[model samples]
Target chain A: MLAELMLSALLLLVTYWFIVTRRLSSAVSAYSVQSWLLGLVALALYVDTRLIGLLLFGLLIVSVKGILIPRLLRNRVAFALVAGRETSYYVRFPTALLIGAGLSLVGLLAATRLAFQPQLLPQSVLGISLAVFLLGLFTTIARRDAILQVTGLLAAENGLLLLSLVVAPGLSLLIEVAIVLDVLIAVLVMGFLVARMRDAVAGTDTSELTRLRG
Target chain B: MIDPALLLVMLATPLLGGISSALVRSDRVRYALVVPTCLVTLALALTLIARILATGPVSAFANWLYLDDLDAVVLLVVVVVSTLAGAYSIAYFRSDAQGHVLRPGELRKYFGLFHLFTFTMVLATVSGNLILLWTGVTATTFAAAPLVDFYGSHEPLEAAWKFLVLAVAGELIALLGFLLLYEAGIASLGSAYNFSIPVMEQAGPHLTASLGAIAFLMVLVGFGAKAGLAPMHTWLPDAHSQAPAPVCAMLSGAELNCAMLAIVRVLSLVTPANKARAGGLHEALLAFGLLSMAVGVVFLISQRNFKRLLAYSSVEQMGLIAAGFGIGAPVAAVGALLQMITHSLAKSLMFFNSGNLLLRFRTTTISEVRGAIRVAPASAILVIAGALAIAGAPPFGLFISEFTIIRGALLNHAWAVGAGIAALLMVAFLALMEPFNRMVFGQGRGEPLPARAELGLGVLAPGYILLAAVLVLGVWIPGPLHSMLVGASQVVDR
Candidate 1:
């Protein structure tokens, strides 16, 4: 349990770094690392319980979400009409870092108050998951670029996965599959949309579709 | 003695038809295909409805698939609306630029996706488990998104993307709410994790008060979105206005009904203990319902685009349903169900009529779509009647249903009922009157359309039948359906 806590804490740190900083590659790498550790935990759970479903699910995550998706996105970024560099956010880097630290601290304090088997994950994991969810939503609203918003969307889904780990044990194999499928489909559809948007107009700022302004 | 296997077949048929539509290469043949398929599905759905009403919520197809009095009522609406819209799409698409612009494969994609969307909605309503129901909605949205972008134009694409993002995000929040609901269910049913609505309703009072309240609010947000109620209804206008007319009808008429049915499904499960402490849940629904009505009306009053106006009417109608359900009285709930039926017909008629308008004018701008009485008198009359019916003017089914809702609202919760009905009436009245006035009275300046621009055969027939059905339901609901409605309403809550 303590080992799982350590791993979760590590993930929280990386997720924070990914969302707080404005670098595109950093956010992508952070999520991929998060996925890597998630596979580890799944593997551990599989070994402990001998639930073959866990092994299959873990492999599914490793191959599809971690490897295949990231590769597809990197290729799209290099070849597709992506704008230069990463987009900036509504808040500054220094302040966002402070805020992230505060969120982690608050999550830890909240974790201490909760009563769950400490072997699963620390309550602070929920806080970090929630905080990551918030930051993802924050990025979607704050960033001007559609690509950034799409990244925020993926980040939010990451937070959902984190929450699922803490709350549900192994009862929901299909549920997890359904959620991930939706995210994959959403990203693919959004990719097509980004291409179309750039073709129609020169950029991908969605706010410009305000043709029906008050 | 009707077999539930037929119900499963009925649900799956339109989907099969949709798939068949995509495989064919001819636009003309593709256009003709969905009609027979819709009629067959309707016949099967009616059979299912009849059997359920006769036997009382027959176990259809499999153990997980059950249709109670509530499901019977909702299923009827879904079948009726989809059939009509399928017919309308034939005419609606061919007259527009898409008929010429669409590659043969794209036509199949649209029709295939259309049936896929219908399949998910049916799966959602018929499923006995809450998880399956939720997943069904999610699947439906994915299936429907491509339909929203079927025009393959930039605006439609963007709208479809935005709609998917907003809806899926709201659904995730709803799932969080569902998790809370599961927690409460655990507290009540003692860790069995039963997902059936009937099982949960019996187990509800044992659940924690705070947990139930949280779940209630979460449902309101989640289903409230698909219901197209305020604060979460950002996608309706853009998607509806941008989608093809028949697609608009499906979205406005059937899709929203399915969402509202979901909320009521959960409501049926919430224990009286929850309702007693959470007195304000109904009030919150009322608030959102009224907000939806007022917002839809305000937008409708100012709108120039015909399809967008219809989209707003959906908001108004959904609000009325919410108001009816919010009152939570058996009488009020029945009224809400009636509202669902009437609104489906009236709204579809409005869209079909608008389909004709777009057919003639080649533009959806209300300001430019005038003198329809001269343009195509038959379609013009249908548009005017549709407008009047949706506005709840007398003789139309919506008028009867709205009257019932307001009357029931006055009886059960007088003050809220009176004020909500008045506000709704005012907005809906103005809403239907304004754009329709332009459609019927204003000078239409566009050139006469070619014969190809006229209403197509595959499209015009289903919409007319739907209009007839709406008229039939308005004047008189058959005994079996009415009996089911009463049974379902009584089971709502005391």
Candidate 2:
């Protein structure tokens, strides 16, 4: 249990890095590391439950999310940054970090207030899961580059899965597979779009997309 | 007894057809394949509805696949719109190819994704489990994203990107809500019960009110985003306006219903738990509804692009339907469902009309094109009729549904809301008419369209059929359909 908490703390740290980082590639790397930790956490859960489904889920997470997706995102960032270093945050770094910290606190408070079944899971898991979730959302909103936003989105999904695993460990295999595959396809589509945006408009920054607005 | 195997066939036909469309080499062969596949799928859906009416409801695969009155209503709308749009795509793309707007090779990609989009929506409508339903919605974003970016240009790509990001973010929240509800379920009913709709409904009263309310609100916000409710509806206009017209029609017409159906399923599960808390849910929905309508009308007044204008109008129509659902009266629920059907029909026809104009005039700006009636008389008339029908003019189905919604609001002692909706509808009508009149009757600014400009029957047939259905539904609903509406309303009614 202490090991699990330690890994979660490391995961939170990586999420904070997502907020402070300005380079799109760094943010992407932070996201990949965060996903690796998430896979580790899933492996820990599998060790406890001895469920082969969780074991396979952990392996898939590490491979698909931690390895495959980051490689895809890196290719996007590599060609994308050749033009110039891009500013990814609308809010200033300090202010965005402060806001992200507050969001994390709110998550903790809200999680504690919920009447979760006590015998089934530890309370801290719920609070930490929510904090991770909120931080990811903050990252998405704060980032201007579309790739970082996709990274932020993946982090948020990781947080949700953390909460779900603790609260409902018995979720059917079908749902787990569906959730993973859904995220995978979403990332693939976003990667394709970002690549296309770079090739067509010369940048992956969403601010460039102001041609049609009411 | 109905054969349960038929449901599998309904689901498989689209999947196989979509795959085959992608693999086929010849565009002509692909187009031919698309129409027949759509027809078969439509037949299967109609048969499913008939069997559901006959057998009450059908559950298969341990309740993983289910069909009830609510599913049938939504299924009927999807099949009708998809069938029309699939048939219409042939002529629509042919014009684009001829005009050099799109290459002939791109038609294969468009047709393939079109069928895939239809299949995802169909899966969402029929799936019995909430998770599977969520899966269906997620798949829709993936399938439709490419379709939206069919042009592979800057504008369409940007629009498709926003559509993907916003939709994924919103749906993830809904997933969190589902997790929370699952936690609540385990707390109440133990772990044996799964996340199937029937199972959740059975265990509804045992769910804690506080948790259920939160879950419902999450659903309203999340699914509401996909439904193009305001604030989260940022993706709607960009994606709708930039997509090829037939794709836009599917996105605006059938896709929004699938999202709303998700919200309805969640509401039903929560309502049985606590009556007053459920009212809170309704109040939240009502607030979003009004806000969406207000925001939509404001944009409608100033929108320059005709396609985006239609997108904002869709926001208004969806907002009205959301208000109907929020009122939670059986009458309002019926109106909401009816408006969904009518909006799908009228909105698709209007979009197809816009497509015709775009092909002829080569522009989407209302101010740029003038004296449309003199160029293509048939298209001009169709656009005018569609404009009138969508504006809730009498003798159209939207008019009836809007009236039903107002009466339901009044029945709920929401006179102010009723008045507000009525005023907004008038403002929307004026906004729409101002632009539509300019395009149809205003003096030409450039050379008149070629005297030979004419519409093929294949192109007009689907839209004509839709307008006729909307007109007929205004004055009359067949017995089976009426019963279906009542049954669906009961599912959501208190």
Candidate 3:
């Protein structure tokens, strides 16, 4: 349990780094690392609980989210880097980092009020998971690059998956598998759109996708 | 009674058909597959409803696939809209191909995705499990995102991207709510955690009120966005306008109804447990519903693009339906169900007619295309008729449903809310009618088409059939249909 909480705090730290990073590649790397931490947490729980389902679920997470998604994002990033495009943000890096920290702090406070019993999971671990989720959402809102936005979404899913590991362990494996499939599909589709947007607009900047506003 | 095996067939047939359709290179063979596939789907859906009404809901495969009266209502909408859209796609695509609006290659992709989209909606409607329902709903975004980008134009791509991002985000939040609810069930029922709706229904009264409130509210916002409710409807106008006419028709008319059903199902499941939670859910839904109508109407009055105009009208009608469901009275729920059916038929017809106008005028801007009466008289007449039917005119289905909703609201002593909805409907009606009139009846700025065939009867046939159904339903509903709607309404009433 102590190890789980420590890993969750580490995950939240990586999420904060995601917001503070200037390079799109680093943001994707932070997300990849965060997903790996989640898979590790799942592996830890599986070892403790001796549940084959958790073992399989952890392996699934590591391969699909932790490894494959990041590789896809990295491929896209390599292309963008060769093109010499930077990961631009609506908010500056410093301010965005400050706001992200503030969000984590807020999430820590909000986690105290959650209705879960303490025996299920420590409130602080839950709070860290929630903080990770909020940071992911902030990453999406603050970034202009479509690839980073996809990474942010994956980060958010990672947060939720982490939370479910501790709080809703009774959730059926089938549902978990289905949810993972959706995230994979969402990333694949977003990646395709990012490629298409680059081709059409000659850039990956999403702010220019303003052709259809009222 | 319809066997559960039949339900599985209904679900599997389209998915298989979609895969096979995508492999076909010949447009003729693909379209030949389209009508039969839709007919089989419709036949299965109708049989399912009949069996449900006869035997009082069916569930099989460990309660993974279930059809109640509520599912029956949405299934009807899916069957009708998909069948008509499928039939219309033949003429629509032929004309569009001829006009160079679409290549034969694109048509193959469209038919492929069309069936897949229909399959997703059917899956969403019949699924008894909350997770399965969410899967179906989210899969729709996956299927339709490419369809929204079918034209491959910059505008369509922009719309598709926005639609995908917003939809996936909203749906993910909904997943959180489902997880929360699952945790709540585990806390309460331990070792008996089930995502099945029937299981949840049985456990509803045992659910903690606080958790149920939080979970349902999250579900509301998340599913509400997908349903194109107000304040979260940024993606609706762009995607609806940019997608092809038949795709737009399905998206606006059928998909929205399916999303609404998902929300309503969650509300019904969670609300029966606690009154305070139910009241809160009702108020939230009412607020979202009212806001959607007002925003939709405000946008409708100002839309220059006819397709966007139709899209906003969908928003307004959806708001009305959502508001009726929010009223929570049995009668009002009935009104909401009736409105769902009427809106599906009428809106799809209007979209089909708009497609014909686009084929003739080669434009979507209402101001740019004038004298539709001269350009394509049959489509123009049908457009006008559809506009009136959509605007809640008398002798049309919407008029009856809207009136019934108002009466239900008043009967429930929600006088202020009822009156407000009525006023907004009136404004929306005028907003929709005025633009349609200018386009169809106003002076022609462009020269009429050269001596050529009007829109083929095949293209116009779907619209005519839909309008006729609306007109007949306006005057009177058949006994089985009326009872089905009433039964469906009762399913939602706490």
DockQ of all candidate complexes: 0.31, 0.68, 0.59
Off by over 4 Å in 3: A75-78, A81-87, A118-120, B101-104, B276-278, B445-453
Better of 1 and 2 by TM-score: 2
Q: Sorted on DockQ, highest at the top, how do the candidates line up?
A: 2, 3, 1
Report, in order, each candidate's fnat: 0.07, 0.62, 0.46
**Full-model lDDT, candidate 2:** 0.84
Q: CAPRI band of model 2?
A: medium
Q: Could you give the CAPRI-style class of model 1? A: acceptable
Residue pairs with backbone overlap in model 2: none
lDDT of 3 by residue, A1-214 (tens): 7777778889998888777766677777788889889988888878777877788888988898889988876675466645343455699877887899899999799778767755445789778877888888788878887777777878888888987776666567887798888888777777777777876787677888889966
| Candidate 1 lDDT over residue span B387-443, tens digit each | 878888777788778877787777875776667677768766976787787778675
Tens-digit per-residue lDDT, B1-494, candidate 2: 34468888888888888899889998778988988999999999998898878767788887888888888888998999999999888888877632557676687778888888999999999999888888897789999998999888888988998898889888888888888778778877775456788788778788877788788888888888999999999999999888988888898889998998888888888887768553588878888988999989999998899999999999988898898898878888898989999999999999888888888888888878788888888888888889999999999999999999999888988899889999999999999888998898888656655564778887888889988999999999999999999888888874
Compute the interface RMSD for each candidate structure. Answer: 3.3, 1.4, 1.7
Of the candidates numbered 2 and 3, which has the greater DockQ value? Answer: 2
How would you class the docking of model 3?
medium
TM-score of each: 0.90, 0.96, 0.96
Give residue B40's lDDT in candidate 3 (0 to 100). 94
True contacts kept of 2: 0.62
For model 1, what is the alpha-carbon lDDT of residue B281?
A: 72
